[model samples]
Target: MPTFTTRKNKIVLTDYNYRRDIENRLFMAELSILEVDVLQEIINGSLKTTLTTLADNLEIAPSKLRPILDKLAKSGLFQIQGDGVLVDKEMRKYYEAHIIKFDDDFRPDMEYLQGLLSKAPIHALPSWYAIPRSSDNIFNSIIEKFLFTPKIYERYLQDLVFDNPIISSIAKQVFAAPDYKISASALIEKFGLTREQFEEYMLFLEFSLVCCLRYVKTNDVWEEVVTPFHEWHEFLLFVQNTHPVAIQDVTPITAVYEKEFGFLNELNAFVKKLLKKGVSFTNAPKDLLEVALLLEIAKQEKQKIVASVYTEDWLKKTRADQAIILYRQSLNRLIANEQFTSFSEKDLREVEKSLKNFAHGKWVYFEDYIKGCLAAVGSVLPTSLVNRGKRWKYSTPNYNEDEREFIKLITCEYLMQAGMVATGYHQDKLCLCLTPFGRLSLG
Candidate 1:
């Protein structure tokens, strides 16, 4: 038994069994260092730290620290406030005056054994195909020791297929077939897998196929015929084109993009074929828009890019030029109005100067140079435009809600394409950055 002196001068023999049980429970559950530290601090009544402070103490970024705190909060061990963290009173009291003991002869309880069996499947599946049977046998023996159902064995097999990269690849290849029916026996024979393994693989593939089918159905493309054999050949061609001589060296952006947008290599090759047939961009705004949409979609889907910023800049410049032309036309209409005749010479001169400024292929100072420019452009400006020029030294765009969102999406996609960042679209709302692995794959 363990005890501690309270603030009331009372010797409290905190329940040793309860403390041991709780400690064991925590040990059994997967906990990160940050989580353990947070729980311990709270138990000791010394939790006087913010997320930022904890991050600094742990030598981790604040972004990474937040997720750990979120997990602790989710587990009901800690209550997270905008100011700080608070531990559950009952849990804190248990840890305050009792210590956990792990004796050599101590074995886990039946409930713990049941939990262990549940986690066994994830442990048994290795990254590689070759499973250490001795380890498998140990896990299988644990299942048998507890007299768990045959479903446990089935789960282990399912995990084995789920974890196997080769099997997953094969399943993806098979999924493209118009009316594909892959025999389990054929898979076993082809992959040198046992019958039990083959059945498990089939089960996993069935689940995956169902998911893919659901997506296809929802998109109203279920009836569309996909030639698996042709797609497979195309994939092989793509793989050949993208293959690197040295695995240590980085992969090209083109290769990464090609992998994400499947059959894109074939599509590009087909486009080149059309180019040989004299296809041109001269009468192709619709086509250009389609390509832009595809690029946007690819960015949303974590695709890579092969083009430079100069190319996109040129395109944007063309669009901006079109917008400028529209602006000039609107300015012309406003200037031609009979209402302008009553203006003073200085105002009229300012108006003329603004028009002259705009005519010279300049956009920045058009408002100061031409009164028409101010009338035409400013007429459309929203009332909510915040004028920050007086308060701040730098000139900022008075971007409305729509313009701000557009800028954010465009900037995110541009940064991703420029290799400065990795981003994916979140429907129509936001863009999420790629993971380190995703970024590395693009390199």
Candidate 2:
């Protein structure tokens, strides 16, 4: 069992015996091999198939398959009609909205996706934990690091030290003792370091997104205390118990997102004002709309579009001026999309840095500049064929479809949850636009 102090609720990591609640256990319940194959057959058959056909496909007799089908129906995974089985309607609709049909070529990949989903962790917060204040925590800092600098975070995860030996040693000590709050003076004495040296080390730990400092009143003096958050379950427990903003309310990501870009509140207000008129989308899917918005935000950052341009007075400009801005932005959007789609998982920071360089409206050819930047940043991509000037040229591009999906997942879905973007519809398609809170956060 993990140890934690009653007063500070600080965690002491000895063994990871984090147990899931009954709800989560049931939610992640593993299916038997027969059950999985049966579901696959149903999905492959467009969510419905006659009893004889399903049994034939499985190389099992109708008599043997009847029991499985009956079991699935009882579990709400299937509905048995007179002669056929149909997947639950709600489940069918969800799969239809999210996936293409499992043709022969992609059926195996579809199975792989199913396996991945079954193993995916289900995250939930208890009702008492308010989500709005969630950003003001160390977990949020770690999440931001993952979002903005995934490659670096991946490297850090390979070694829990995060390349800083001092902090790692300190964290180890904190973890070594359970239910005891180690004081600042004691750590300084134990490590045989000066006060300034200890403070600097603590600062590095906090800044590097590892452990953090809290205050605990010991005897007559208020002393500094440190604790380890070695696992996600422990962090979730901390968030539930901790009220970080006991006095002033602030979220860490809000400040981090606004770094080097400044217009979040203004952009948020503009979006709200537009939504007051009521908007609807006819043909846009939620995911597609989010991607569209991310692209638009990137373009806006690259062009350094003033808040004024997004206002109604933009229509007051001359046709030529309007046409020029429209044409350039439209053309830039295509260029940006191409560059984004071409990005490797390791090159996300490269893309983000390139956009930030243009935040002052300093635009350049997308491919040429990215190739140069990739080279400068020491990307592992082969650079021999980079400057041939041919369109759609990639220099030894290593494509990982999973990485691309993860990037899109965090930027699109997680961004909305962070209050950086708002969703609606425009011109009969789904639209996502930045709120003022997200304005300066794009690049």
Candidate 3:
């Protein structure tokens, strides 16, 4: 029978043998590190520990440690009682009833026994642990070395690490096209990953490439850097030679690239421009607004707009002015729509007056005109109705003018609801426009 000597100098049947002697067997063959530690403590009569104590000892959060204990209990290794865990009474009785003996010099060889313990297959381990720790610490050492000595890494791994081909292909296509840029958020939407997972995968891929293939980090986000095809080819050859198993199963790498390339390609161009312009120049809100307006203009022109005019002088002279133009253009498009033609002359005049007021900085009157027009179009309810103004003297209650105006601009949903304006959708938001009665009054 297999046996283990406890730290207290008592010989006991191993969990496997004790379980077998009691005519019970584990359904699964492996336990996590925490489980192994907890089992050893239980056997040694030192199992009294709270969740916090376990977390402190294990260097993990109490919430994280609790799940590990729950898993052990669920797997029939122990019975959790109140705040403590106990050995399975039957298994313990079996151990006591059929005690095993070993040589006087027989000491528990933890390292050897742990090695003997059948662990989950490499593929079955969590990706965080499995991908880094497998193949006799190959990936782990590489990641450590790359993070610590980035300069040495650049010299050694640059030729071997390849640029992500998927992103490069997409970027080439985007750059080749006129007046178009990919949307980073749209690409993320396609993959449906949480922000954290996307970030983790990006970091993992970048570090892996840098250490194994000798890539350099040239951009704030590593994904934004341009990698040459020749470098990538050499990197693939290196991967094939150094880690045959990883090369054999390239599905993980491929999946990550396929999922993220659409967004990364667009972001790469944006980052390149931002870096060239310098941080102080690009950080201004006006500069950003100008970029947005230029992008919009480029969309209209069907041409790409380079950041050549992103200078301080350009921002001081033209950024805000261009934004105003774009805003005016947006309003003009709304007024020209077929639905607005049915508006009465008085209502059209009100809209024009509001547009002029907005141009001259009478922000409050401009807001009212925009809201009244939206109400006339049935896109949003009048601020009064949604705000329950009937009970109060003022049409807009509690909300300041700025707050009401902000809501109207953001939730204008003409493209939503099949291009029709609807009020119920926006709920209590001053987002709803006028009913038919209100529209007829404008006429």
Candidate 4:
């Protein structure tokens, strides 16, 4: 069992055991290639060897081998005494078999996905493979790394770690325990996350299938709390072990779709109910509107988008000016879609009256236009992450015209971060478009 305790401002590591099969509790510590080579030397024990002789056999300095031995020893594999590396008797058997699990040969089986998808119901397909394992379907290379071992290693930050750092950090802390248990308030306050934000992150985790609910006593009452999904830890470990890679490429960590995994499930439900009712973005719940652009990006079949003139600059403008920028983009897209035969300046005179409220932050109208972009997946009732300043309270984004563009700009940025749209500068314009999965969502 692994344990963690803070000692003099440093996290102390102890008893790091990989309990994939809780009963067996394999002492499977992550090791470097060199470390594995060193362990192999000791385990082979083919000839009587000292550090100097072993170093000669491996063609490396004895000094270099010392640290590798230390790391493995600290990881509970061996001990060093009187300049001789001592190995535990039982380890001779275990380490030899365990050695392959850490080698560079691990690859997620392409057939794993095929088997999983085949087992899934059409209604629950999103749950099985909403995110791709890799860019190419012929090989399951992408699915291999995207699993649990090394998400931070991937080029695209689609996994939870990059999508929402705070949430990912919380998940890490939750797992860094003998068992997946942690104090709730201490976690929130430790990271300076508002209660509402923590709750939002919890929902994101729940959707990812990384957490399940348990109860802990709080203020004399038992309360439901979030903890690591024990079942998943074992499964993820099994998946990675069977397809272990020594290390993944260095990928810069950035935020990506935190809510996206859950969004798919939620959107599926929302669409079923939404079609029966007349809910435009104006009256659409916050969660629905929050994810409104996801469908739009899906329709475009692009991962990123260039906002061009539709950026924060529009938010700082006067209400009428903000309307002009947003309304123009809407008009252009509508005209491109053949919604209008030939719109021009003369048409704007009449269109402006209808778009006046939309430009002034009648967000639902914008969402209504985006409806055609979605594949009718479910979405949850819209909600807010902004601290409402009261217990269980709700506040609309923009109650005044000046607040309209502010909300819109923020939404656009969020849509990009959530992988709904990847916003970037393309040819000196703000580009907005669908991502890979975003296009996949369309299918």
Candidate 5:
């Protein structure tokens, strides 16, 4: 939720509540830009308006608008009476009480959209792999999570691969020409779109991170320039280049983008191989272990850096240029020595033995995987207080959750991100397995 206010005849959403991940995921998925605009128009109107009136306000033809209205109605967004639509009682009450205004348009400011999705810049790295492997799946599970079968344009350039002819044409034109630029008016005329439709569509495309639009005010007329991604690497490069301004209160780390892209190329091949075999990870790890280890090193070396506070010093120096240089040296030394840097030889052997016990290319519960790993090290689970049933709970003081978290930190958080493991769901339970890369690396 965000605090809604009217400033100079424009609606501004400020003070965004970040603890709305589940709600944000659903809201982004369930409501399209056009749907939100339609709902906004209805709420601003009498809350009961004819399709013709609503369509006219939204600048959409009644025939083209009918399906959107019907879909919203089915979802209990509003009620339909023949040609008229009425806002649902509960939904209207909530909107009026908390969000909507009678006079101002409910269109959210683009700044708020960018701020709300600041994490997008971070996701661009993994997306370098995802857009090529399966652009439809949410990238790295770090971007907007599109659970199950996601809709087109749910996240990360999906709209480029949209089934709609107009979008397909747009994608082809953009990709066919590097740094394609088109004026708003010209694009609208070329695509035969109303002004409102063009705004909604472009806004959706921008939100999907497919392109970036820079608008200028000239002689009281706003003109927009669309710069679409010309290559796969351009997406991350754009994010990296613009993150300083786009993401507030966060310093953009100078990552080795060329090196990262090289790794992504390898990861993309592995994912494509899996997809070709009709196997894709439903869940993949987030966070980079190298970054984590470097951060730890930075913290240990923070005495030399000057800052007002410990957090400030830590954040400033963790991914700083000097730190990156130091980390590279440290990493190379470890690699040259062939040392087990992160774990003991015993622990690594135990994990390998545990993984070897299970057959690959099959789904098993994540808990089962954790239990097998713990068992390989001769760990025992206490019996339950009550008699065992079809689904029995372990006794208190059991190390299941603790061990699961630690193991996932190594396997899911680190190994999976390294393309050594892939996780998915089987019967609604999280599961994991070794990838072809993982088997070869281990062997």
Candidate 6:
């Protein structure tokens, strides 16, 4: 229940109370830039407005906008009233604040994305996943608890996958295929699904990580592929008290998610601790593992953070608590950038400048390369591979410039090759700890 307030004509969100996993799910589902923009509009526009008026503001057909609007409304940001829609005053305020902070137009114009999504298939990445979606499901750790064991797929089968007979039949048909592909004709039989349900199932699977349209040329269209990213199986090992594998051992999948999404691990581990207590459903029990991940982050950096503050619900995080997270994320970057080089105010300013010039998702090349560097260094962000020294056709839109490549090589590959981050064993896993140089960079 984050509270919203207006500040300088923008809404501010406080007390981010919703579960992080929920937000993670939404982001991973590739919430189009347009949808986020629509949220911005609701917050900044008149509280009471008709669908047509909103549509007109975005220059889209009201008919085309309705479904998107309706879906977002389910998030409790708004409600469909008699003739028009009315938004929750507070959530509207919250969104306004969020948009103002980013100060970037990440508007997902749906018309462009829908077309682009079809064209984009998962390509061979730089031996690591760029970033996995929905950190909660990364290892399927918490999600697995909700699902039954022995047959992992069986858990979600009844509750989600086959809950709708149509999707159930679709699942069965698709699973029967020798490969992840199933002909479209196979799913269209007998179900009589409304166009809406079909679309819903498709979207759900994308989020669920059950499957996605990776595009098969012989099929000649984007077709659902089963169980996104098979290498994610390595993450399942975390459930056991097994030998520690170095962070580098995890990959083909990007390391960013393991670090970025580590926040949720605390919550998920806490829930399991409660479940073990066998407490009544209504009674919320103590969470033993809460804050464990943050503490781990602190320990790795030779830093310390208040346990209670970082563990508090995101909505309840103090400004200081929030700053700690941001500072740590930045610290990791600074360490990687200069390899233990001390950063002056000017140095920090340059980092900020780069971030401002290349907002998240804008500089895909730099972002990916940086992520690769963080993964290589084993920073707050995680990498999938443990060994360095191999280059693949690391595919991304060409942002090629001689300087950029040199920087990427120096920042990511050379850091490890030169031993800027000390590497060794920790609990049977690969450990990449910050070196003396890295420690100095924090100052």
Question: Can you give the TM-score per candidate against the true fold?
Answer: 0.18, 0.25, 0.17, 0.23, 0.23, 0.22
**Model 2: lowest-lDDT 10 consecutive positions:** 5-14
lDDT of 4 by residue, 203-322 (tens): 445434345333443464434445544333443343333321211221221223333333333433444444344344444445544343433311111332222222333234453332
**Alpha carbon lDDT of residue 243, candidate 4?**
29
Q: On a 0 to 100 scale, what is the lDDT of residue 288 in model 4?
A: 40
Q: How do these models rank on TM-score, best leading?
A: 2, 5, 4, 6, 1, 3
* lDDT score, candidate 1, position 249: 20
Show model 3 residue runs off by greater than 4 Å.
1-28, 45-47, 75-77, 88-443
**TM-score for predicted model 3 compared with the true structure:** 0.17
Query: Candidate 1: TM-score?
Result: 0.18
Off by over 4 Å in 1: 1-28, 45-48, 95-443
Name the best candidate (by TM-score). Answer: 2
Best by lDDT: 5
Least well predicted 10-residue stretch by lDDT in candidate 6: 1-10
Ranking by lDDT: 5, 2, 4, 6, 1, 3
Clashing pairs in 5: none
In model 5, what lDDT does residue 399 have? 47
lDDT tens per residue, model 3, 1-443: 10112212111223233333223212111334455554444444443445565566667786776777777566454676666665675554433321211112322222212222222233322232223444565433433443223234343333232233432233333223232223323333545645443333333233223211111222322111122122232322332333211122222222111221222233334434543543343343342334344433211122333344433333343323433333334444445546444333343333333232122211122224343332222232222211122121112223334434333432232211111111322112222232232232222
TM-score of predicted structure 6: 0.22
lDDT per prediction?
A: 0.34, 0.41, 0.32, 0.40, 0.43, 0.39
The residue-by-residue lDDT of candidate 5 on 235-299, one tens digit each, is: 22332332212112112222222232233344334333333332212222222223323334211
Q: What is the lDDT for 280 in model 1?
A: 38
lDDT-best of 4 and 5:
5
**Regarding TM-score, does 2 or 4 come out ahead?**
2
